[model samples]
Target: MLLKTDLTSEQLLAVIFDYMAKISSESKLDRVLVLMANMGREMIVADRCTVWLIDEAKQELYTTVAHGVKEIRIPAGTGLVGHAIAAGEPIIIEDAYDDPRHNSDNDKKTGYVTKSIITIPFRNNDGQIIGAYQAINKMTEAGKFAPKDMELLSLAASYAGKSLESVMLHQEIVDTQREIIATMGEIGEIRSKETANHVKRVAEYSYVLALGLGLSRHDAEVLRTVSPMHDIGKVAIPDSVLNKPGKLTDEEYEIIKSHTKIGHQLLRGSRRELLSAAAIVAEQHHEKWDGGGYPNGLKGEEIHIFGRITAVADVFDALSAERVYKAAWPLEKIEKLFREERGRHFDPAVVDVFFAELPKLLQIRDELTDKE
Candidate 1:
């Protein structure tokens, strides 16, 4: 009941090359792992496949994002997969049930039978063992794992290790950037003595709105990372103006409005895409949809969509969260204000999308509630 392959070695190499090329374009960690698992299934002609990465901190092997069996973890040196990992080599088991190293607890738990398996080890640049790649129940006429299967699966696992390394390193850089962003945003907020977590809430809210407005995930992520700097310019404002308990006088209000330009000046001219996007958001977040707001009275579609989307997110989070000068507005009042300001203070499309996805927005707000 299996399809046999008549392809030559050259064809298999071509297939592996194509797999590498395809995965290169994927960046998300979960997507990359699932893709790797599916690729292994095809390469080894297996009925089921999975990838397990080591949790060095926990000294265990755990599933990444592979589908099928529930996410599982087993201590190092526990089973066949573990045995191959501990040995630092690929193992082709023709009869998994007879292998003393085979772990049958999973089969018993899932009510599934184990016939054959190939387990390969993944290594880092330093040749350190990092994880295991496994293919279950090879489906060819021979009905067993082959030597070539080990070589190909091992090569695929190596590619996966490199990809994982790239993604992890990129995440580290992203985390560092966020720490700096939060630090800068917090510094600005502290100057105004504004409530905590304002920047974080705005970033999350902006990301939600971006997705609702049909921005690509990459674009949404850019907004999520950059929107926190919307008020980065408050750093330069005098404490008297920034931290005023109540309403400000005319001159004070005018100075407060200048913070937008100040923020823009601080963030502009960055070669980094994140900073460049944040610069636009900082400069235009206060701009209005009806030609009445901001340092520049740009109206309608003239306002960069980034600013328009951020405007809705920034105000929604600001009003919902308790502020230094004001109590948190009830959800009823917030929804009414969004409805009332639809085309006046905010972009109509942005406001509509916000309400349409209210559940997700509220979940984000409640989950990331500000600390005391």
Candidate 2:
């Protein structure tokens, strides 16, 4: 909320126009939220700010950007935010505590003291209220939010509803994609007697490692969706080879290794990036960092980065899970195995990054566990 530079009228309009221009279904909402809040602070000379969306069905206001907050949701007509929404207009409070409508509970809960405040309600084209933008504790020497602050905030809040709708559309598309990816991955694994959640855990672990290794968010999400198909080739193997309860015989092991090529062949030459990436991961996930793995035996950096990442992710999840042929390894033993396998069975850099993000990896494990 602290101003690094003075806000001129031209600069303020520039910030608003920039975000408005970028507003679309695929635009990054979190980045937009941060920018909106920061720019609001600069404009109002306030120490804190929040942008909250209304859930008309539930008659609630919720915000994800509040300070020290996981999420804050309050019923409509409950506080200053509610008052502004219910009034369908802006409210400026010079003395926050003096106003009965002000809610100090959030301030107390977050260890922040509220002194002055401004609230602006956003309205849709239909004249329905959509949300409220609230700024708290003006840092000006007067220690008060002026009418001009309310006027500027109202103008900014007007465009927020359009941005929110775009974000919702984007989220709907992503949710549909998640279901489709999970289904495709599950189809291949379920046929082989493997745990249905194996593909999911692999996908999650791959994403974590991808992000830890400095991959872009787009690349990380792509890997998460595509890594699930690493074993799609196993669908071609006979059930006798796939679901064998005991150790695989030498001939059967060879057959199992052929799944890499079989899976790759099944998905190769697809123009779609998902299928293409899946094909590459399917073929190379079994390839080792030391060139000792089956199929191609490509070594070290010769293996594709996606393959290297998926290999570590797949091996970690497989080793730690209880399969029909083996007991789950102890967490400590798994840790040691990965450490020992670094630069031998796994890419040294990928292994290092995988372990560095161990907490998130464990969380992913818990999130996509096999049903008991």
- Against the reference, the lDDT scores of all candidates come to 0.85, 0.81
Off by over 4 Å in 2: 1-26, 55-59, 68-70, 123-129, 183-187, 200-226, 232-241, 244-280, 287-302, 328-372
lDDT of 2 by residue, 253-342 (tens): 999999899989988997766667888998999888999986888998899889999999999998888876678898999999999999
Which residue pairs collide, candidate 2? 233-263
* Candidate 1: count of backbone clashes, pairs at least 3 residues apart or interchain: 0
How close to the true structure is residue 140 of candidate 2, measured as C-alpha lDDT? 65
Each prediction's TM-score against the native? 0.84, 0.71
**Whole-model alpha-carbon lDDT for candidate 2:** 0.81
Q: With candidate 1 superimposed using the best TM-score fit, by how many Å does residue 363's alpha carbon deviate from the native?
A: 4.9
User: Model 1 residue 90 lDDT?
Assistant: 84
